[model samples]
Target chain A: MWGDKLSEGIMSIKEQLQNRFDELTRAEKQLTQLLLQNYPASGLGSITDLAKRSRVSTPTVARLVQKLGYTGFPQFQSVLRAEVGAELSNPIDKYNKWAEHAPDEHILNRFADSVSKNVRQTFSRLQTEEFDEVCALLANTDHRLTIVGGRISRSLADYMFTHMQVIRPRVTHMTSNSNAWPHYLLDMNKDDILVIFDVRRYENDLRRLAEMAHERGVKIILFTDQWGSPISKIAAHKFSCHIEVPSAWDSSIVPMLILEALIAKCKKRIGIKPGAGLTHWQACLTVRAYSESSLRAFSG
Target chain B: MWGDKLSEGIMSIKEQLQNRFDELTRAEKQLTQLLLQNYPASGLGSITDLAKRSRVSTPTVARLVQKLGYTGFPQFQSVLRAEVGAELSNPIDKYNKWAEHAPDEHILNRFADSVSKNVRQTFSRLQTEEFDEVCALLANTDHRLTIVGGRISRSLADYMFTHMQVIRPRVTHMTSNSNAWPHYLLDMNKDDILVIFDVRRYENDLRRLAEMAHERGVKIILFTDQWGSPISKIAAHKFSCHIEVPSAWDSSIVPMLILEALIAKCKKRIGIKPGAGLTHWQACLTVRAYSESSLRAFSG
Candidate 1:
């Protein structure tokens, strides 16, 4: 019965960890605290390393693993490894997993369903006041706006920056290069707004940058996933978008949609005449003719 | 009666142009041909310039504008300007338009509904055989893959390139610089795949690049919007995503989702092991101890 319960997915590893938390001895509790802090990383290490880091004996580590309903340390590690794998798998891996579980569903249908749920959940969770506050901050041209997004989210940052640049003159998207970040952060003032996009497995650099910006009294607006990242605590306005998808990779549909809504609100608040900038930009493109001949000289 | 019909928005400018095409005089035909060929641009020019370019008299230009249901040449120009504005409005402008149309609907709800419709329409329009063919080509590891996206689409190209790079080797996203394009194009072979993303207000340079690649026997996969572009004719594989949204700017949610689907299919065909690359990358980040302290020195 015990073996069947362990194999049946009766409880998630995290749930098991929490349920058994209070029952652990002092030495086990020390290791538990370390495990909770370091999380999957602590689980990835060998028994000895976990003991050494937790400041407990190797026997304590083994006992904790067995008590957690695993046969041994390897079994415990396997669960952690699987958890981490699910967290970091690419879209392809995620699709395969979904296919296995729901054999009847078409991949396209699955994708459509996942995206729909994500957008709906995101809006349902958002507070009206918080969204308005973000819009008000963006609309205020006096606050020099600096937007940052991590590796995968760099595209989103670019999207927001491009749209916002046309709406207001002072907006800038920070470059991906870590070296240039400090220079940008140092220039930020109390009145400025620092918009950040950092999702799960949040970057260390982003956290540090947010910390520095907060110190400078820059109003921080953070867009994160449902996981609710560490940076959220420091941000003056924090909004979490649902990124859950059937695949291993988190879908960015919610965040992108939220960005659209925010841009719309900001435009309304700023009273930007529709098509004014677009007309000017299009006229410029027209003047340049934006044609093959104009580009050919450079190609040659 | 004529004024009422004009006010009803029953006849778009293009439709009006087509409906009255056969009734035009010979000089008007020449002007019409020029207007059709250069389109929107033709409407932006002065009457004298249009007459000079089409080798017609200035009165001929005015006659054509009047025949198209406008009060005069200036009225005709105003309609064209409005069309162009709708084509090029930024996200903020788009949001404002949506807000004005549906004041009762929350912006978040509107966004969700728009994105949901976009994804559904994109999938509904996509032919399964074409998607599978695109997937098959991408999965072939022997083929060198090169991706190019227009200015606004550069981020998407980057997103695809980044994900594909991890799944397999030898995938590259082309730089936007015109000077470097020739060098990249010259290296294409029959076995290589050149994926281009150029939506409406299509760039002439992109069209020329596609033409050049076709001459070299390179397989071209073109991803565009519903209007279809000039490059579609030359491409071996063509796919269009629906980008209609409440905003002036085209939402990229559909295209991004399609890319994810393509990646999933390619991964399946290629038989890539689940979590193989992700594990390696995560381990590297872990080894680096991706944290603030590690990044602090760079800031200093």
Candidate 2:
């Protein structure tokens, strides 16, 4: 495992949990999952608190740490505390202040302006042919699709996976766990599509997966922030979305817009009809809403 | 349980599965969860397809259907098909058409305009005071926080939960399962906050949840689409974000912007310093990237 080499002292608690998962006892495995699901922070504070959160005894926590090769709970926590530095993988430690040059305005207005500008700028650079090409590839069911995103962007990937899975078939949303990627990779065949989302503070594992998938003739569709991800070199199609927001994290809003558009277009191209019940129900709701005179600020 | 009164005929498959989950064998329970996660879509396809997706045997599927009170697979399927009509409680079945007034422009351009306008419009009417109040409440660990979102919006809720859980303690992200909410509600105290995201095709169960949470004196902070959800009637703070987009489903981008902004504000309010390790690592990464001279575009 790639992580094993990094295990000496560099591997994160998350990495250790994933690499050593099979060896853990059932109760300890549950605790490991809890720690992994909310790493660093979940491991910080105290062993008693972590144990209470996972509903395990403090001794179980101690044993798990000892099993992971930590001297004890305190050592495990120090490593966790150390991870605070290397874990700036998403939009974080920013958004503490507004833009330096912005004129005085309500913070809400400033954020709105920033996000609105992001959308406008993103579209200005987007290529219609690329968008159409992505839709075409996705509309074809023959292209077994696998989607992966970074720590923050996985939510977007999951959204795309959910919509794409419903619109057609052969869609897979890879778990955030990198250790499981190779198993999923073995299923990839030529002409299959892999949608990768990695913004700034790019993840190397995803790039490695993209390279391997590329070597296997899998077409890559990448969604990255404007600054671009290192994964672009291997990508067959890339959508460089504007993600910079005034917030602590880069926003997923623009990528989300493109994702929705792609889903809508693919659904249109595939041309599958929804159930009659839904059509009737929707029509009724529409009429009722229109007759009642809408109070909604806006709706899709 | 509310599901019982509706179970005779009117109850949906989701309600039935949740209501009867405890009685199922372990494999059947897994099947039940698979169906619920994907809902009407997961159940609407062929029985074999559904079984293969869940890795359950066809007989298990049949037995599960029988246990759910169906005479046979086709009967259970008919119910699933019927749900297509009533399941429009999300941003589904839209994005099939562009605004009639749109000229000969690329679809991506039109979408960018629409979403950018959405951000602008949402901000123009947003109340900064309410935004601040929501942030203040979230910053306070004394006020336990429970967040929920309907069908599609739950992704956003999960994103918020992930960030908030890392930012502070006393945060709970309720599962999409409505049946499980009461258990979480039992722990709510006065001044606790319940943040909800419900778009068009608003969920009745969510409204009921809000009402119940309101009765418990838990402060309600709602993030609803422009058409507005009925839950607004009970909310202490309401953010009616614009969600319309030219897509098959309502766009989550606008609501995402607001959620990120709120998260940023809360993190700021909490004012926790990162461990020395992360601060040093982030500084190194930032310096390296800056010196390299970015090849990509916009950055946060």
Candidate 3:
């Protein structure tokens, strides 16, 4: 890789420093580390000031940039600024690192592994008594079930709410932003069951909804990752699981799978039998599937 | 779990049969199996026909209603129909076998396992030569990059496009479903890279866009789960991974992680320096965070 290295055109300043890291005197080494660790500050620093911090001469600072592969101090600073900007835009690497540590496997196997891990963690950490109690409360509720999730969690909430509504036929998903959810909460009552999926630090809007549900005497079933997450404290019943994937970015799918299991449990509770209702559901699927296929065909 | 006692409440016909399965005489075993396996058909079958199929007496079929905890055949059929409807509405579960399995540690772990498995399978199945060629193409592209994804995959595309844009400032994210994207693509040329994240069965609009990009001689990079999936064949450059999740309900985070890896590679290719053009991104975050906090404080 090094042999076919920078074609002289875009050779970065960092590359130049690597080429001469050991050859440089002690003062140059200090300057290099300082620049690498605090490149942003270097962009705004003058040659004299940067040399003072690195304990190097002003001429040595300029020489460091050239050796680092930059045309000059200004060019080196531009590269530094760009690198800092890229980091600020996306923190995905931290999230993906968790996947890298796991052994290689197929998508199906990976899915199974992820879900099983989530279920185990959730079950072990969970107070089964509380889970069953929440189930009991939900089972007894006469009013509709309402689910709330936002950002990345919204897709799971939408799917769960859609299926639950079909099976139990009274589930509603709240689609509004955090601030707007209170209006929806107004429609909920003591008989209603409110399910909230919030992870990590927890969003203020979801926390507010959890609080309001408590005040309204509505049963709240909380699914979150962080133990100290704000939503956990106020929930009437809670299922906590760790989704500590390496990154600061949240790429965990535990919450979504939890919703899937909840839907399954709900199905079992509601009782899936075989007869006219089942036939009706099949009929509905057929019609829906046909419509979907036809739409795709036409659109194509 | 069943005693000779039956609860004096309405129960689905299938449940009734499960309760009465042991009580049925030897002659009714076949009938019970038939009812459990094909509940809908058994519900509609006449007593004589059901008896003939089960090789039992008509009296035995007649006794099934009371034994199964139903008032009559009609009531039994109603429960059967309800079960059938519920089954049709939720078709993913081919069996109740999952209940037989042990629950694992955490949902995240299960998801990771699933992803790792898929990654291994995908890696083995992937055409290395094609992957390298595509990476080389992407690395060499002179024009801005454009990415598109919808539904759950949108997060992955958004993640990839955001990171890539910082490395190459001309990247565009086509997020909305509006027809606005066609106008944007009209100007794309051979120099520009158009990346599509199409997993599973290819989405409709994405297929059309891929076809359009191909026709225009625009460089196309496709990231997909399955190799034979419709989107795979059309791309000028393709990378396949096992993105299938257990739920078949889109609950896995593997694809998002794959996007992360791809972004990391792209970052390496373009040389993600520490201080590069980062103030703009940080400034945006700072502004948004400050404004949001200020707004909250003001309201309080």
Candidate 4:
């Protein structure tokens, strides 16, 4: 019960940063500002990287983590990682957790709450300026957009490709299996944008592909989870989505939300007619109506 | 401003159903109970179908719709359809709508609110008994599961297929192309479950495939938007997700959430260890350490 109470009382790292804001040394305050601005990503990388980016010494970063009640930077990062993982745990896990504390709440209600929280936390972490920059990259007509995602993330890439292709030309979703990366990258240059969705347990091939694109001077926009992929270092623009869910599988809802938002921005920027794609798709459906009608006849 | 106020005052069909619950006659109340138990779907079917199922006269169904303040059942159904569409609209559309009323709120906050509302609305419409029945059908080892989606919904099928494959054997995601349906359906039978995702502007081929599957006596579970596809008539289990968004494209977040929930239930029923799939996936990532390290090298 004490442990449960302690856990309940414990402040999240973000909360700790906010609470300790006034008490920090000038250097620590600067580091905290950087962390607050970038967040999750700022906390995910190695201490040296954090130190360099925050313009603070490595010891200062260690001291800040200590001041936040974490044993060290690794412990601090682990808390961040755990937070991300907890956000993505399955509904059942969340239900069990809720049951332990509040046994009367319905499981479905708990799930709804968790999902809403995940979506909220995701958007809350997003930087508007960074989002706008990525949208600009995607909206550029001259830029050849090549999108790729790890094995599981491939669905997201496909979803984005399908929607983006409707509003703009030359948008390709690269299949991870095709040994065709070399061919696909052959013509890609500085003007091309390589958007990759690589999260934790990231596919090595995807990383290699990102590196290859980076070497070729292709601008890479990386979308990953809070675990922070190695490709983030080489990325021109990096978006770290919060993927934690109560299930075994990472919640793709946040990533999907980002994809939807980005597509919306691209459509707006490209001046696509409000219903051009839907109208075309509807026409295609009409042409196939004979079979649809027959199916309805049988059902009736 | 009055128009905006009027729009705000418009009660969703669900709200109307609740408000009018106490006023219906016994026959209408039975129909109301049926509608309450199988919402959206209960409201989705033709008037004759609803009348027959609710054990009420056709005119009674008409009276019920009129009592709900609609001109007719068609008008009532259109409101339901619009509500569903509004749930799936893009974040920008939601932001603009919010801006017209709540001018000081942030766009990201508005997007978050809309997404949360969409997920909540989707779950609210889902019947617990129906969800459990679907899980039971999916978890039964005796039944072969075949999934198919319309052209745009193919990624969702793939996503479901991949996750289901990990927890259970013999799960198949049938591709819409390759003219492979004949081969895939050759062995399907009464015991098999054919899960089809066909939303608004439903594909003719997918409907035909469902009809063919129906002819073979295979059980059909259809997932569509609130527009309600014709295939619902043939489906043994029909789930209409809220796809209305602020943008031109339908939002798939609600569907994805359902997929995740279904998979979670199936995993629970099948007794799969929570971390088994994740552990194996982690192993695969470890095997590809060279590329991962190379990526880290670049980052460092």
Scored by TM-score, the top model is 1
Q: After superposition, how far is residue B120 of candidate 4 from its true place, in Å?
A: 1.8
Which ranking of candidates, highest TM-score first?
A: 1, 4, 2, 3
Question: Tens digit of lDDT per residue, candidate 2, span A211-239?
Answer: 78888899999999998899888899999
Candidate 2 lDDT tens digits, B52-121? 9898898999999998888988788756644543332122213423223334366665676677556654
Quick one: best lDDT, which candidate? 2
Better of 1 and 3 by DockQ: 1
Candidate 3, which CAPRI tier?
incorrect
Worst lDDT run of 10 residues, candidate 3 chain A, spans: A93-102
Question: What would the per-residue lDDT of candidate 4 be over residues B178-266, giving only the tens digit for each residue?
Answer: 26677787788998999999987787778778878899999999889877899999999988888876666687888887888788777
Cα displacement (angstroms), candidate 2, residue B295, comes to: 28
Candidate 2 CAPRI-style tier: incorrect
- Error (Å) of candidate 3 at residue A153 is 4.0
For A1-300, candidate 3 gives per-residue lDDT tens digits of: 455354444443444543344456557866775653333334334568788987878888888778756688767655654443344345343223223223344332344345445445554455545545665565543667888774445655655665665555466788735545656767878888888777755676667667767888887887777565687777777767656533324444556545554554555555544445464335545555443322244335
Please provide, for model 1 over B1-300, each residue's C-alpha lDDT reduced to its tens digit, 9 standing for 90 to 100.
Answer: 467456537555654654455456668866875665444556555678779998999998998888776788878876765554444333233222222223437776677667766666667667776777888889877899999888677777877886677666688888776657888877888988999988877887888889888989999998888888899999999888788777767777778888877876776656544554454335445645543354588545
The interface root mean square deviation of candidate 4 comes to 19.1
In Å, candidate 3's interface RMSD is: 24.1
Q: Interface RMSD values for the candidates, listed in order?
A: 23.3, 25.1, 24.1, 19.1
- Evaluated on CA atoms against the true complex, candidate 3 attains a DockQ of 0.01
DockQ (Cα-based) per candidate? 0.09, 0.09, 0.01, 0.08
The true-versus-predicted C-alpha distance at residue B210 of model 4, in Å, is 1.3
The TM-score measured for candidate 1 stands at 0.61
